[model samples]
Target: MSVSVDSPFVHKVWNDSELSKMVDGGVQFPMLSDQGGKIGTLYGIYDEEGGVETRGRFIIDPDGIVQGFEVLTPPVGRNVDESVRQVKAFQLVRESEGSEATPSGWQPGKKTLKPGPDLVGNVWKEWSVKDNYDK
Candidate 1:
């Protein structure tokens, strides 16, 4: 889902003119409008002076808790792939009941760290960066 200060009509126009070309059916999720920056302000992305929300991607869990978030200036675009990866990581951790932790660049089926007191300060012996890229 996306939220911006742009009105719904602007979203429609932009989707029809720009987003459609990049995505097969435009965006698959909601593109909500936040004309007065109400929602954006809550997320701390609203630029009151600019009257626009900064580019941001937030991964909110089912409990309404923000599991992960990234905010960037308008000049830079967010990374969808990275966002997806983080979401997957968050899901995995949740499914495991916080028993597991994803290493950097972790992907599905990759080895995950078993977080515990014994593993503290010994992570280097258990996992390595190579694990992220290995088949």
Candidate 2:
């Protein structure tokens, strides 16, 4: 699952408790935190003065390479199901190329393209999708 760095998304005690209940009701996820804006800063997610991360989502591989990154203002919400879909796509691509990354909202069994300095627009155009991701 993917979450914003802003409201209704956190890895705090309250969130953990709620997640635990969700888990008891059958939900599973590995939680992560941008706590104190440390990781946020490293990823350029800091609001600096407000000391709170605005809104950002990053899909990273095991090697800590960022496959995708998204930053948003609070007014806009993040796309969740699409994010999961992308993870599955990344998993597939990674397995296929032996270590490759996929673009946003990607899904399994689709065409996987390589990314590089010259392949930006192509990457976005290739993976750009329209869907109601909120459940």
Candidate 3:
């Protein structure tokens, strides 16, 4: 779910346009419009003076709590891929019974850290660098 200060009609127009062509199948998520900036204000992303919001992405859990959020400046575009990865990580941790933690640059099927006193000061020892993470 994506929320913005634009009207729902404006969202429809933008969704139909070529603005999001880079993403395969374009924008498929529900785009909620915060026409009065109420949601943006609630999320602390609305700029009252500018009458616009800095790009904001929030991942809320099933319990209505914010699990993660990212706010970018006007000039910088939000990383949808990173947001997706965070959502997956959050879900994985939630289902791990407090036993697993996703490491930096983690993705699905990647190695996860098992948090414990043994891993407290020897994370580097437990997690090895075997692959090109950038690839």
Q: Which of the two, 1 or 2, has more lDDT?
A: 1
Model 1, runs deviating above 4 Å: 133-135
TM of each candidate vs. truth: 0.90, 0.55, 0.85
Model 2 per-residue lDDT at 61: 94
What is the Cα-based lDDT of residue 48 in candidate 3? 89
lDDT, model 3, position 70: 82
Overall local distance difference test of candidate 2: 0.65
Clashing residue pairs in candidate 2 are none
For model 2, the superposed segments whose C-alpha errors exceed 4 Å read: 1-13, 16-35, 98-106, 110-135
What order do you get sorting by TM-score, best first? 1, 3, 2
- lDDT tens per residue, model 3, 1-135: 777788889988887786477667778789898887898898899988888878888889989999988888899898778888899999999999768999887888888989987888898875655531767
- Output the number of the lDDT-best candidate: 1
Candidate 3 TM-score to native: 0.85
Q: Candidate 1 residues 16-46, lDDT tens each? A: 9999999898978888999999999998889
Which sequence of candidate numbers ranks them by lDDT, best first?
Answer: 1, 3, 2
lDDT of each: 0.89, 0.65, 0.84
Output the lDDT of residue 62, model 2.
Answer: 85
Each candidate's clash count: 0, 0, 0
Residue-by-residue lDDT tens digits, candidate 2, 12-88: 55456776676674345545554567777887878888877767888999888999878887678887887788778
